[model samples]
Target: MEENIYNNTYSLLKLIREKKPLVHHITNYVTINDCANIVLAIGASPIMADAVEEVEEIVSLASALVINMGTLSKEHVEAMLVAGKKANELGIPVILDPVGVGATAFRKKGAEKIIKEVKLAVIRGNMSEIKSISGISVKSKGIDASERDIIQNDNLEYGKDISEELALKLNCVIAITGVVDIISGEGKTVFIDKGHKMLSTVTGTGCMCTSLIGAYCAVSRSYFEAAIAGILTMDLAGEKAYKNLKTIDEGSGSFKMKLMDSIFNFNHLLKNIILR
Candidate 1:
């Protein structure tokens, strides 16, 4: 099983590079640049076009569509719907990042509307946001996951239950990312314990994860595997970035740079290391 994951990820990364699939993003301004950069780092193309006038046109040219609710606004929400409907009509895979859906009624309402309308291939979010959207009562800390909602060893089954329930309900893959990333589909659940706490300190890691998922989904047949690959790429790179930390004074700023570097260099890393 572990080997299958590594091989599948390698194949997806190689396919992404070969195809250079364009990923259309109707995302927030807070992490728009980082979201674009990470998609490029992972060997895919990104276009950030949220204006309603051209959103559907851009999404038509894209291999995958990403809908993010980071900087939630009524106008952007409309654009997201337009793009998502177009993608669905064309059979293009769509990934949703329900950023802070648990934080406010507006965010929650917008997210629910998207799910109710768009046929998402995958729904990626933190524990709190996923729980809240699943109709499970949860506590949220602004845009972050509440400490109480995070998945841990003691609550692993509980986390899986929520993830699977949401995935089954939405008929899409559900990925809850945090200290213990849980990705659940119709019949399978994957847990990734490969991230660093420093990952949370960064501003756009969650958005970046969604971008990665979009990239993989563009070239992969399995949305579930694509979600796992997306989350694994970020988690492994984050863990590697922290491992490569050198100076004592290096903070989250430096760590962010290294994190991007690790992602950009992961293709090269695979060249030298044997998967077996």
Candidate 2:
């Protein structure tokens, strides 16, 4: 099964090279440029169109659509709903990032609306955010989660159970990212024990991850395969970036640059990346 997962992940990476799927991103402004650049870097074409009037048209031409609720507005949320519903009708995959799902009433309600309206292929978010939406009572500091003081908090037993239950309930792939990333669906759950701590230091990394999942799904029909690959790619890139940053200074600026460089150079090693 492990071998099959690795094979499946590599196949999706190869599809990125062959199909070069077009990804339509209705993401936030904070990481708009990074999201677009990362899409191109991963060998996928990206279109960032969020206006309600043109969203459907843009989605019509895209193989997959990504909607992020990081910097939400009524207009953009409407556009996301329109585009997401249209994508569902067209059989185009849609990935949703419930960025701050538990942070505010507005965010939770907005996320619920999208979930009810769109047939999401996959939904990705942090532990606290995912827990909140999945009916857990974990608290979040704004958009970020508080550290787990207990060592048991990092256990996959809890995560796997939550992921499996939520995936079944939502009828969609659920990706929970943290020290370890888990994707659960269809009575099976997969975990990718990769990624660096520095990844949490930068903002919007999770949002960018949602877009990358969209890019992967654009070329592959299996949402599970696309999601696992997306998480693996993130881990690989972050590990590589940490290696490059080992000699650099410790400012947020330098860390951000190295992270971007890692994603930009990720394609060069995708074929040989190790996925566990």
Candidate 3:
């Protein structure tokens, strides 16, 4: 099963590179550039269009839509609804990153509204954000996840339980990313533990993961497997980039560039060496 999963993930990576799927993003302005670059790094094209006038048309041309509520406005919310509905109608995948839910009522409302309206293929967030969206009593500090609410070794079982429950409830894959990532869907769960702590120091890494998931889902049929592939790609790249930084004696800024470089140069040969 492990080998099969590895092969499937490798195939998805190849497909994304070959297909170069168009990923439409109505994402936060803060991370919009990073999201676009990350999409390109993973061998997908990204189009950021939140205009209500052209969002539907843009979504129609794309293979996947990513709705990120990191920096929300009324106009962005409307665009998300329009694009999400259009993506649903076109049978394209939609990935939602409820970026700062539980931090503010406005963010919580916007996240809930999107989830209620769109048939999401995958929902990605940190622990507090996921718990808040799942209706659990958790608090978030601005866009950052609460450290206390983070899943620890002792709470692995509980984390799996909540992740599976949320996946069942939403009828989609739910990925809670942090020190460890828990991806659950269709009553099955997987834990990806191949990331670097430097990822937390970087902004928009979660949003980048969402865009990467959009790329994978664009070509893959299984949302669950696609999501796992996306998370693994980001985490593995982070691991490699951090090692590169250590070798060169650089900081987070250099690590960010190396991360993208790692993604762009990533291949099955490196996958076998890094993914185990």
Every candidate's lDDT: 0.91, 0.83, 0.89
Off by over 4 Å in 3: 246-249, 268-276
Count of residue pairs whose backbone atoms collide, per candidate:
0, 0, 0
Q: Report how far off residue 233 is in candidate 3 (Å).
A: 0.3
Question: Model 2's lDDT to the true fold?
Answer: 0.83
| Residue-level lDDT for 189 in candidate 3 | 93
Q: What TM-score would each prediction reach against the true structure?
A: 0.97, 0.92, 0.96
The candidate scoring highest on TM-score is 1
Q: List ranges where model 2 is wrong by over 4 Å.
A: 149-154, 246-251, 273-276
Ranking by lDDT: 1, 3, 2
Give lDDT: candidate 2, residue 187: 74
Error of 2 at 112 (Å): 0.6
- Best candidate according to lDDT: 1
Q: lDDT of model 1 at residue 179? A: 82
**Ranking of predictions according to TM-score:** 1, 3, 2
lDDT tens per residue, model 2, 137-237? 87777777657611133578888888889999999999988888889976788888777888878878888788788888998878988998888777778
TM-score of 1: 0.97
